[model samples]
Structures are given as structure tokens and as C-alpha cells.
Target chain A: SQTIHQWPATLVQPVGSPLSLECTVEGTSNPNLYWYRQAAGRGLQLLFYSVGIGQISSEVPQNLSASRPQDRQFILSSKKLLLSDSGFYLCAYERQGAPHEQFFGPGTRLTVL
Target chain B: QQQVKQSPQSLIVQKGGIPIINCAYENTAFDYFPWYQQFPGKGPALLIAIRPDVSEKKEGRFTISFNKSAKQFSLHIMDSQPGDSATYFCAASQITNFGNEKLTFGTGTRLTIIP
Candidate 1:
């Protein structure tokens, strides 16, 4: 079975600090990856998605950016974090041909103080 | 604009009671509808889904009922248990030639099943 993994299960960062969260998938190839943010009492917001290595699409404009350097490795980074950046960050994967069902990782809880 | 709208921001039901969550969409192009379950501090998981061609789909204790003409769908949990307490979200997507890559999700409903 395929599984998604994310690092830094929980993070607390000072304002203006750089941020880097990572996500990697195992047991699948050429899968689509996505990044989302969930604010308190708000719905999940799409931040970025990648089709393949070096191919990324931004769903919403933000200081955060995503990169896919390897087939199964995806990274979300920011040079400087803002208070608004605090939220629950999630990473999801959809099979290459089966896009309707998406599998999500454990997720990272980020608090920008 | 929000493409998918879900009602009853929160719901409370007794164990063994049936809890239904409803959702409606405005886009006719949408052909796929899915329901997801999320636990606190955890990512949402796919519970069940349905296509426009089918009026209903079921898996285990969960069921999805679709109304294409009404552009609405609902989730019905049978014999609900305390363990079923969590947040549920309804989403819709239009399958293009490439596939349904993007999903428009509803705000989500928080459910509590008390024993």
C-alpha cells in the first residue's frame, strides 16, 4: 500500500523566520502532490500542486512556495514567515491516472508567533 | 465564490442514531462527489464518493446519496458510534480529459456522537 509522510509534525517559529516543511511519498510513482493550509475554523486552502519534478502550479498567491526536486520528494518553503502563515499544513497525493481519490499525509502543525 | 456549500456547520447525535450531512453545488460540470472524515490534528481521509451516473453509493457504514438534477448530495452514517465523531467535508470535482485534479471542498461539518 502507498503512504504519504511529512516531517516536523509540529513547529513553532518566530515571525520573519524562514520555513521549510517536507513531504515524501512511498510505494507510488508519478503521483500528483498538493499543499494546503487550514486556518482555525476555516476550510482548507490550496496553496500549490505539482504534476512532476520541476512542474508546479500555484493555486493561490502567497509568500509560501513549493518545489518538487525528486519524483517522491516535495518541499514547501518560505524565506520569511508571517503571522498569517500559522495554520495546519497538509500534503496530499493522487494517483497518476486515478485522480478522484487523494491520500493525505499526517500533516504538520505550524504556529507562527 | 464558493462552488460547494454545506449546511449545519455542526451536528450532535446520540450513538446508534442516524446523522445526515447535506451539501449542494452550483456547477453542472461537476460529476464526482466525495466525502472525507477528519480527526482532530489529523489529515482528512476519504470516506466515500459517488458519480453523477449513480444515485447512491455505499461502503460499510457510510453512504453517499446523489441528486444530479438538484445538484445536491448527502452523507448518511448508519448506526453512528462515538468513534465516528469528527469533522466531515463534502467536495466536488469535474473530470476533464486529464482527470479530476482539482477539488472544491465545502466548509466542513463537525459531528459529535454522544454515548
Candidate 2:
């Protein structure tokens, strides 16, 4: 069975602070990874997706950016955080040739103050 | 058409009652519809899904009713339980030679099961 792990389960950052969240998947190879944000009382919005290492696509323009340095490791980074950046961030993985079923990680809650 | 619309932003039902969540899409290119369930502070989980070729698909206590012509679909929860109280989202995607890489998610419907 495959498992997804995210670090810094919950974070509180001050404005203009740097941000880095990590996501790694185990038991899968060359999986498609995605980053999504969920605001309070709202649906999720896709921020970024990667097909392979160093191949990233931005779904929406934002202060956040995503990078895939390894086959199973993905990182979301920001040089300076904004108040609007506060939200629940989720990382998901899908099998390369499987159906569009997305398996999500536990998620990270970030509060920008 | 890249949007998936869901209605009844919130729903409340008694235990053992049936709760229905409806969703509609504008893109005929979408070939797959999926319903996800999310609890507080948790990631959304795939509850059930259906293909346009099938009218309906059921798994355990969850069911997805799809209408290809109408471009609509719905989720039916049988014998609803309090544990089922959570936010539900409906999504649609098109699968091509590349893959269904992106999914358009609806605004979401919050379901509450009163015990």
C-alpha cells in the first residue's frame, strides 16, 4: 500500500517570512503530484502540479510555488508569505496510468499572521 | 467548460435517512465524475465515482448517479450516520491520451447527519 507524508502538520508564520512545506510519497514511482489549497468554508483550488522531476505546472498565479526535486519528493516554497497565504495546504498523488483517483496526504495548516 | 457546480451548500438529515447531494457540469468532454468527502482538518477522500457510460454506481452505503445527456450527477448516502457528517465535493475530469491530470472541483456541500 502507498502512503503519503507531509511535514510541519501545523505552522504559524509571520508576514514576509519564508515558507517551505514538504511532501513525499512512499510505495509509488513516477507518480503525478499536485498541490491544492483550501480556504475556510471554500472548496479546494489547485495551485501546482508536476508530471515528473523538474516539470511543474501552475494552475493559478499566486505567491506560492512548487518544485519536484525527486521522483517521490515535492516541495512547496515561498520567499515571503502573505496574509492571504493562510489556508490548509494538501499534497496529492495519482498513479501514472491509473484512473483519476487522487490520494491526498494528511495536509498542513498554515496561519499567516 | 471547466466548472463543476454543486448545490445545497449545506444539508441536514436525521440518522438512517437518505441524503442526496447534486452536481452539474457544463463540459461534455468530462468522462469521469467523482465525489469526495472531507472532515474537519482532513484531506478529501474519494467516496465514489462513476463513468458517463454508466447511469449509476454504488459502493457500500454510497451511490453516484450520473446523467450524461443532462450533464449532471448526484451522490446518495443510504442509512446516513452521524459519522458521515462532513463536507462533500463533486468533481469532473476528462481523460485523454495524456491522462485526467486536472480535476475541476465544485464549491462543495456540507452534510450534517443528526443523530
Candidate 3:
């Protein structure tokens, strides 16, 4: 069984506010999507990745941006948000040729006061 | 050189004692190596992986000791459990050119198994 969903589990924006984070995967199909960032103890940082539907690939370059708009959906955006942009935001998946098993989602705790 | 160096950021054992976490990497084209387990708000699981012709890899209580000419790698925890505490990550994989696969994380190791 596959399941991965992420949303406003926790968020408190401020300082130029504007950001959207959402990731969904119910039973898989296309797969291979990722966007990770964990700071506050620091480690995991990959920013963006996608392989189908509009395609997107970015690995650390700032303000944040990612969109797959359907085909399992995946979106992580920002029009303005900084204060280091806060922390803990992860969404991952893999299966397009395997890519060494990656499945995680259940995170999104951004607090940019 | 993608860099992946991790070690004793924090560790305290007691329940049966035996905790070791160490990682070292600097590209070398990185074949693949993974280890992750986080539990404090969640999201970071997949706690065993090794590939580089495999020097050692166990799956029960966790054990991975690989050294492809000292590119170094280690993670050992046996007889240890306080529910195994949390936070421990060490990853290195390179296969991107948009072909898929890319992960380089290691700046985490916060294991505490006191009971």
C-alpha cells in the first residue's frame, strides 16, 4: 500500500508571507517527485525534483519553486517568504525505474515568524 | 565533490549500550549508500542500505559497515533500544543528469537510548 500526504500540518508565516506546500500520492503511478529541506538541526536539502507532468528540477537555488500540477500532484511554491524560509518540509517518492526506494511524506512545519 | 561528513553530533547510549554512527564521503562518483530514521514530527525512514560491492550489510538490529577504500561508512546499533531513540541520517547517492537519483545528506546523528 502506498500513501503519502502532506499539508498544513503546521505553519505560521510572516515576513513577506506567501507560500504553498502540498504533496499527494495515493497508490502511485508515474512517481519520482521530491522536494526536501530540513533546517534547525540541519541536513536533508534537495529543493525540488519531478519527472513528469510539466517537469521541474531544481536543487537548491533559493526562494523555492516546484510544480507538477497533477499526475499524483506536487506543489511547493513561494511568492515571497524568507527568514531563512523556516524548516522541515519534505515530500518524496520514487519508482520510475526504482531509483533506490524513497518514500516519505508527513512533514511541513514551517514557522518563519 | 559533493561532501557528506557526519559523526557524533550527539549520542548517548545505555539500554544495552552500543551506538556508533560515522560517515564520510567526497563524491568519488558515489555509488549509493543510505540510512535514515527520524521520529519527532516524522518523515525520514528507510533505515538500511549499502552498495559498493558491499563490505557488510545486515538488517535485523541494523548494521552497515562499508569502506570502499576509506570513503568510509558506519552505523552500528545492536542490543540497543529505548525504542531506538531517533534522528540518524547519512546518505550519498549520485545519478543525476536528470536521469534520477540524487541525495547527499549527513549532518544529523542524534541518538539517545537511555533507559
Candidate 4:
């Protein structure tokens, strides 16, 4: 069975501070990874997605960036966080071929003050 | 442009009642339609999905009805329970130029089950 892990489960960052959120998937290789953000009572917004190492496609332009440093490791980072960055960040993974059912991690709740 | 649009931003249903959520897409190339359920403070989980080739698919108490010509789909939850109360999201996706998949999500609908 594959499992996805994300941390820290909750984060409180001051405005203009740096941000780093990590996601790792065990028991799967070369999986497609994605980052999504959801505001309270709103739909999810796709931020970035990575097909392979060093390859990332950003959907919306914002204060955040994503990187696939390793095959099973993905990181979401920000140089200086903004107040608008506060939301629930989720990391998901899917297989390479057909029937791509995405599996999500526990997610991180980011609060910027 | 919002590729997918979901209706009834919020729904309240009684236990054992059927709750339906609808979604419509603008892109014809979208071949996959998926519904996700998310609890508070938790990540969204894949609940059910359907391909364009199929008109309907069922899994346990959940069902997805797809209309190819109208580019519309819906999720039906039978005998809803309080545990089923959560936010539901409908999404559409197609194969990208790089062979990767990208999903466009609709505005989520919050479902509350009244016991």
C-alpha cells in the first residue's frame, strides 16, 4: 500500500517570513505530484504540479513555488509569505498511466499573521 | 476561465435521504470526471470517478452519472449519514501536452447531514 506524508500538520508564520512544506510518498516511484490550496469554504486552487524531478508546471501565479527534488519528495516553498497565503495546502500523487486516482496526504494548515 | 462549475454551494439533507450534486464542464477534451470528499482539517479523498465513455458508474452507496453530449456529471449519495457530511468537490482533467494530468476543480459544495 502507498502512503503520502506531509508536514508540518499545522504552521503559523509571520508575514514576510519564509515558508517550506514537504511531501513524500512511499511505495511508489515516478508518480505525478501536485500542490493545491483551499481557502475556508472555497474550492481548491491548483498551484503547481511536477511530472518528474526538476520539472514543474505552475497553474496560478502566486507567492508560492514547488519543486520535485527527488522522485518521491516534493517541496512547496515561498521566499516571503503574504497574508493571502494563509490556507490549507495539500499534496497529492497519482500513478503514471490510466485510471489516475489521486491520493492525498493529511495536508498542512497554514496561518499567516 | 473556470473549466468546471458545481451547483448548490451548500446542501442540507436528512439522514437516509439522497443528496445530489451537479457539475458542468466547458472543455470537451476532458475525459475524466472525479468527485472528492474532504473532511475538516483533512485532505480531499477520491470518492468516485467516471470516464467519458461510460454513462454511469456506481460504487457502494455513491454513483456518478456522466453525460457526454452535455458535458455534465453528477454525484448521488444514497442513505446519507452524518459521517458523510463533508465538503464535496467535482473536478475534470485531461492529458496535458507533456503527458501529465492536470485537474480543474469546481467550487466545492458543503454537505451537511441532519440526523
- How many clashes does each candidate structure show, in the order listed? 0, 0, 0, 0
On TM-score, the leading prediction is 4
For candidate 3, what is the recovered fraction of reference interface contacts?
0.67
The DockQ-derived docking category for candidate 2 is: medium
Ranking by lDDT: 4, 1, 2, 3
The segments of candidate 2 whose C-alpha lies over 4 angstroms from its true place after superposition are B96-100
**Tens digit per residue, CA lDDT, model 3, B17-114:** 88999999978898989999999999999899999899999999899999999899999989998999999999998888878887888989999999
Cα TM-score per model: 0.95, 0.95, 0.34, 0.96
Q: Write the per-residue lDDT of candidate 4 for residues A39-101, one digit (tens) a residue.
A: 865688889898899999998988899999999999999999999999999999988774458
Model 4 clashes, total count:
0
lDDT, candidate 3, A33-77, per-residue tens: 898999866688888888788899887789989899888889998
Q: Which candidate number would show the highest DockQ if scored against the true structure? A: 4
Q: Give the root-mean-square deviation of each candidate in angstroms.
A: 1.4, 1.6, 14.5, 1.2
With a 3 Å backbone cut-off (N, CA, C), the pairs that clash in candidate 1 are none
Give residue A97's error in model 3 in angstroms: 28
lDDT: worst 10-residue window of model 2 chain B: B93-102
Model 1 stretches astray by more than 4 angstroms: B95-100
lDDT of 4: 0.92
Clashing pairs in 3: none
The lDDT of model 1 is: 0.90
Worst 10 residues of 3 chain A by lDDT: A40-49
